[model samples]
Target: MKSLILHTATRLMIGILILFSLFLFFRGHDEPGGGFIGGLVGAGAFTLYAIAFGTDLTRKVLRVDPITLIALGLASLVVSGVIPLITADPFLTGKWLFLEWGNSDIKLSTPLLFDIGVYLCVVGFIVTVIFSLEEEN
Candidate 1:
């Protein structure tokens, strides 16, 4: 049975949850909250939706297969590791890149890439398990 209130509230909360997940992800590099927690929160958002609606609807909202997320995450991790080796740095060494756009300077780093990979993997794994469990029922 679907609760109309739950479906409506979940639709609203999903966006907020995703936004907060990103905030946590960005803050992770320098602060305490990193990819792991961010990904968990992200996965929780989907899980909540699945409960309110159904796993099939959640999958449609996801747009891509969970396995694809895992694949991309792994690839990103490998690339982050290999990038340092290309410069003769130790494996998994942090690399920094700076970009200037007009008056704004953007700092990019390998660690952030690695974190992104972690986030994707965590979200993918959790979602896959949840979907599978739902399908079994």
Candidate 2:
């Protein structure tokens, strides 16, 4: 049994949740929020959608399999750690690259990549569990 209002509300809420999760992910490096929390929020959004509109539809919306996300996340994390080794730095050392646009400088680091990896890994794990459980029921 599905309520039209629930389905409509879920559609709007999902986008907001995903956007907020991204915000949390990006702000994590400087502030309190981080990949783990962001991923949890993201997974929550999807789970909400799954609950509102069957797991099959949720899976279809995702397009890519959760397994793939998990693999990519692991690979990203490993690569972030390995990149420092190539530059004679210790494993997982914070490596920074500065980009100059106009007068402001933008700093990018391996930790950000690691955070992204963590985010993906968590989201994948949660979604997989949710879908599996939902299917069983």
Pairs of residues clashing in candidate 2 = none
Poorest 10 consecutive residues by lDDT, candidate 1:
1-10
lDDT of 1 by residue, 7-123 (tens): 999999999999999999999878889999999999999999888989889989999899899898898898889899998999999999999999998889998899999999999
lDDT of 2 by residue, 1-137 (tens): 29999899999999999999999998898998999999999999999999999888998988889888899999999999999999898999989998999999787999989998999999999999999989997
User: Which residue ranges in model 2 land beyond 4 Å of their true spot?
Assistant: none
TM-score of each: 0.94, 0.94
Give lDDT: candidate 2, residue 109: 90
User: For residue 1, what is the lDDT in candidate 2?
Assistant: 26
**Candidate 2: lDDT over CA atoms?**
0.92
